[model samples]
Target chain A: MEIYELTVHELLEKLDKKEITKEEILASYQNRINEKEKDVQAFVTITEQEAKEEIKQKANNPSKLAGIPIGIKDNICTKGVKTTCASKMLENFVAPYDATVMEKINEAGMVSFGKLNMDEFAMGGSTEHSYFKKTKNPWNLNKVPGGSSGGSAAAVAAGMVPWALGSDTGGSIRQPASFCGIVGLKPTYGLVSRFGLVAFASSLDQIGTLTKDVKDSALLLNVIAGHDEKDSTSADREKEDYTKALKNDVKGLKIGVPKEYFGDGINTEVKEAIEKVIEKYRQLGATVEECSLDVADYALATYYIIACAEASSNLGRFDGIRYGYRTKNYENLKDIYRNSRSEGFGAEVKRRIILGTYVLSSGYYDAYYKKAQQVRTLVKNEYAKNFAKYDVILTPTASNVAFDIGSKINDPLEMYLADLCTVPVNIAGLPGISVPCGLNSEGMPIGFQLIGKPFAESTILNAAYTYEQNTDFRKNKPEFKN
Target chain B: MQVSKEEILHIAKLANLNLKEEEVDTYMGHLEEILNFANIVNKAPIDGLEETIGVNEAYNVFRKDEIIESLNRDELLQNAPEAQEGMFKIPKVIN
Candidate 1:
């Protein structure tokens, strides 16, 4: 196998045995990135030279996961790197400091492969909304890679990088990972510091890992997850080496299959893939059974309300003064604010901002925003009740396989359906991981998500790892166009 | 449930965004659909539930009131669209 095709854990093992050097690993990925990046279009910026220099500088580092190549979503701040969040507003904005995750990655000796693309401000489900370019699914040239973390999923799936960091607001990480046939883990909210992540929805946004396998997700989590005083909401807890949770045992573990997630709108093929996954868990001595999670019905609506509200508030800072794009035709301050925002933000972003404003407006605030917050409480309480019985809940990562690009972008409601199966976890502040289960009839990858209790990333990762060890799906890789 | 062009423009005004003539219709149609979809929240059985402003458990996080080295002003100002004397220069607000 080419060095770039190996999982992060596999590469680390190779690095340990002197079979490959860090410089050699970086060179391999750079070569693969050169070959596949055009078709994948997974990156907003590619830092091959910077990565090569870093490998040389950190050759003697003692961290276990050091020397692995990883990419960052454009939203995550890296010192002097362009962190655009794939919006024209921040097209030229360079972060002067590193995000806490970037600091952790650097301190752990991982090489930075530069930034990936996303929806404008992470306001859409498809990466097509990116101001730069739409990332294609590595599995199929004509299909979307999914978003707003499409670039992260596509790059890792294409093996351009061993793994990459992605932030999820409403299924941004898991949906793309499912579409691209890779592992994506969105840790519990506040488990990872969001100090420098360009905030989309502060309450729901979380930094996660996209990798070729489950162990890499755990390994990357070990580096990125933990408390940061910079992020006041960051979880204050003891750091656990997530790699130690990689046991291939799910015996007696309880896995709840939310039947609500399978019914209505989910494709038959995706449903069967998840069923087979459940059966696999059952056969491995795990107690698996169907259960009702009625919260599934309202998650998307609640998500849009809360996410857009938070987005409108969080995005108010970009007024063309401090940084980002400025309107050349502005004479007064009001002119600058309106024109800069209008020109800098894309259509989806504008729609969200308007919707947010409408919801939080004087007459409608109690009905829309307040109602959604109350429903958010219900959603969290429902998930809490479920977790009280089940060790982890299982669901299809997305309702369907990756659809063709441009199919749903024009229809906003149809586009929102892309996140139906995955948004509930974020609504409840739970850790969820999407792992490749099997292929659909069209040869597209289908994934199942394991949702765990808050601060219980180890549980979900262990369950996903157990499932991965038993399934041959992990052996598959998408064929990049020659 | 019904939004007119005046309402959308009003919302755009509140959001500090300017919509082009055509984008107004596009956003209006999409916003109505999204709001209709989001109206489902009003029907949810949350009668007795308390609102959750945020999921993170941390509240009123206080930090030590001590001086710490901060990001360089020159470096930060380098990103400003208009900067003068290490400050973000804007169109005069107080006329």
Candidate 2:
């Protein structure tokens, strides 16, 4: 098999046995990226030279990620590397410092492959909103790879990279992972530091991993998950070795299936796929039962209000004064601010900003913003109650498989509904993983999610790992040549 | 839920954005749809629930006031659209 097809664990085994050198693996991936990047369009920047240079420097203490070439979603700052969040606003903006995750990756001697593409500031469900280019699903070139971490998911699924870093606010990581047919984990908010992530929605944003299988997700999490003094919201707690949770045992585990997640909007094939996953878990000694989560009905509305409010405030930094794109001509200071932002931001971003400003405006605050916050509390309480009864909750990652590109881009509301199944977990600050369950009749991949309590990444990872070990889903890869 | 072009422009101004005349009508329809969807929050049974500012059990995280070296001023200004004397330059605000 080609080196590009190997997972991080498989590559590490080869490296430890001296069967392959780090340079060989990097070169193999570079060759694969060169061959398939045109078809997938999964990258905004390819740092082949930088990656080659970094692998030459041997590490003093090698970690599990040593010598692995990993792609970072463009929103994460990478010091001198250009960190554009798939927006023209920061097209030429190069960060002066690395994000906390990048710092950890650098210390572990992982080769930074390049910056991947996403929706502008992670504001959309499909990468069709990206100012640069839309990433196609590796499973079918005509379909979307999902977004705003579309490039990251497509890169991993296409075997262009072993694993990649992605950030999730409202299903950015999991949805794409589901569409791309891979394992994606959005750790509990505050579990990973958000110090240098280009803030879309500060309260809900989290850095996560999109990988070929569940084990790679845990290994990557081990390297990147920790508290940073720089990010105040970062949890000040002991870091767990996530890799230790991969025992492939699910005996006596209680998994809850929220009926609200499988309501009217879900596709028939997606429902069947999730049912098969539940039956497999039951056969493995897990007690899977259907449960009702009432607050889920209000989660999408709550997410829009809260996420957009935070986004409007956080994105105010790009006003043409300090950094990012500025207008060519402006009569006065106010003109510069207004013109730059209007010219810099795309349609979806501007729409969200306007909505946010309206909701937070004087008379509307109590009616919308405050009301959403109260509903958010209700959602959190519901998840807390469910966790107390079940070890993990199982749901479909998305309502359906990957849709054709441009199908839902025109209607923003239709696009927002794609996040229906995954947003509630983010609302409650819980960890969730999307693992490939089966494929639809269209041959597109379908994923089922396993959500765990706050700081219970180990629980969800164990459940996913057990299910993955018992099935051949993880072994499936897209045939790019076809 | 009924958003006029004037309200759309007003909201755009508040957001510090400039919209073209043609874009205003598009935004009006989109915003109206979004607001109608956002109305779902009002129907939620949140009559007596406490408002949550954040999901984490957060408190004021404090640290000792210690000086830490930051990025070089020149490196920071490298991406500025307009920079002069290590400072970002914009149109004169006070006239």
TM-score of every model versus the real structure: 0.98, 0.99
Tell me the tens digit of each residue's lDDT in model 2 across A242-321: 98999899999999999988888999999988999999999999999998788775999889999999998998999988
- Model 1, span A255-317: residue lDDT tens: 888878877788999888888888899899999988889877688898988888898999999
Question: What's the count of clashing pairs in each model shown?
Answer: 0, 0
Weakest 10 consecutive residues of candidate 2 chain A by summed lDDT: A58-67
Model 1: runs farther than 4 Å from truth?
A: none
When candidate 2 is compared with the true two-chain complex, its DockQ is 0.87
Complex DockQ per candidate = 0.87, 0.87
